[model samples]
Target: MHAPPSPLEAERSDGGSGSVRIGVLVPLTRPGWVEAGHHLLAGIELAGREVNDTGGIAGRPLELVVRDTAADPRKAAAAVDELARLGVAALAGEYHSVVARAAAARADALGLPFLCSSAVLDALTEQPTEWVARLSPPQSRGWRVYADFLLGAGHSRIAVAAQPSIYWASGTRVVRDHLAPRGGTVIELDMNALTPAAVCDALVDHRATALLLLVGHPEPAVSIVKAVRRDQRLAEVMMGAPAGQPEFAAWATSLGDDGAGIPFLRYLPERLGPLGARVERALRERLAGAPSFVAFEGYDTITVLADVLRSHGTDRARTAESWPRVAVQGSRGRIEFSRTPGISVWQWTGTPVHVVDRDPAEPGRFRILHAG
Candidate 1:
């Protein structure tokens, strides 16, 4: 019941004395997510630098009071309190849905504006609050997109490999809910209960044409992929995952050849327009690696936050009040929100979903298979 620990350092340019500070929440040293946190932090920092270089918001520079949630929900909620206490104009940046849920609750209670960068649990947006907004589409909508894509690809008998996390659970539930009634058969496999060999057995037994993975962590998914790739019978069977999109590099690096030809849902396009291309290049140069979907999420989240702070000044209430109407152009598309049912309060609607498949011809390269 102690408050979440504050960031050791505030990231900003020189002359931050008059800068506008915003709370940036990310899992910096969380178990199994250190690399992801670095990617997110890089994106947010890139956005902050861009805004400052362009004269900042209302002629004042932007600074981030970053807080590490360590992938803990309680800590995330406490971080919200600490951020609000620090007098930030708004809150932004998140990678874990569980943390996002807790942070959303705290933001609602404090009447502060919070923009989720990349957490996609459907219920995060379903909460009754006016201050919470998300840059990513909720899983309720995104999963359906996955389901439709699978069914349209002529995949009828599908097997789902799932972990026990709520994020994975939500994904399995949506695929089952959407695909079952469409004459598609779904078989669920618990990642903990089933060995890679046992999962392969089930796929062969069920004659499943495709496997839908709900496990978020890369190691489990990697094990399953490695096992299936060695089986000749399962070689032709398609494998897809909603959770794979964000941590694809980790999975690919581990699974190697097994990772190729696997399909996953991504939030942004592989290709970009002029503005997006510039941002993507900047992020790649800054991170010294390929840009992730969450990087775009981080960049877009802060860009929208800068716009809100610029127009509404540093008043949290006015920023929350103005959230519903503010339409800022993001790296992907126009970032806007409305009070839509079955979504979080002030959640952005019509967030695009794209299916990218790891190329078999060229390892580690993802080719856009479908766009929606």
Candidate 2:
């Protein structure tokens, strides 16, 4: 178990730490975002409940302030500003990477210590201010992890299909980096330039050993699977990270046994530490009728935030200092942040990797291809 910091050590102030106040900003209507957000909130609630159950942080109950960004960047900035004016000790979240930029800016202006839970895009934290720290692994890290997994799997050729979004552009270079040293080749495709049918056509021509998909939205991910089906090449391809959204659930029907066969490289699972149990229990209990990567991620993100509150005596200064130590055992294993630029932990450490086999008729609906 990781040890908590001592009082003197915990006194470091990134922002004036007083009563622990957290302002949460998320897009409440981004289809899968809300359900995922609920889990995150649940995690926060659970942590708060524990602290209050134990007698509040520093003898004061934590005040959780929330606002909906509606997945809009302008609204996100405004929401953070509103939260800052309300004088939150620290700020946590804005789900979309684009929205996070605005919220993060507001936090910086206030000199408030802010930690972003998701927003894995590289540019999200590129130019750090005194107020920001990202809890999610950077986009660059995600790609490198992909490279490692594929290269280690003995695949020498890979093809890339990325969602047409700014987030994916930031780490596009990592694909080459991962392939560089190993003599593997990477082929790239743009979602905007090609329809699912077009994408499927391109994949057929590549004939690469594996597929490196950086799709963020579920609709496209599902479409890609369907598009590929025309050629009946489900087994010929694989997937990496950014495949955890609730939208992927629809693909299970079309791919059937093949859908369950998709490989995943992502964060959260039992290895991240306390998060695995946290997510499994939350997903199984509250979201019993559902399955999603975002559900687990959202839950773990809020759970970590709540724990941060309890760590620093519920005081703002302590809360700010506690950001660095706040760790969540996500579905993938323990997730933490680095103060360094272009560096974040993405390895599963001691977690399990689950690949969804699209083939429903298969007994191995999911398998642990790698166990940390």
The list of candidate 1 runs beyond 4 A from truth reads: 1-17, 245-247
For each candidate, the alpha-carbon lDDT, in order, equals 0.80, 0.58
Evaluated at residue 248, the lDDT of candidate 2 is 42
Q: With candidate 2 superimposed using the best TM-score fit, by how many Å does residue 301's alpha carbon deviate from the native?
A: 4.5
- Candidate 1, residue 357: lDDT: 79
For candidate 1, the per-residue lDDT at 199 reads 95
Quote model 2's TM-score.
Answer: 0.76
For model 1, state the Cα shift of residue 16 in Å. 5.9
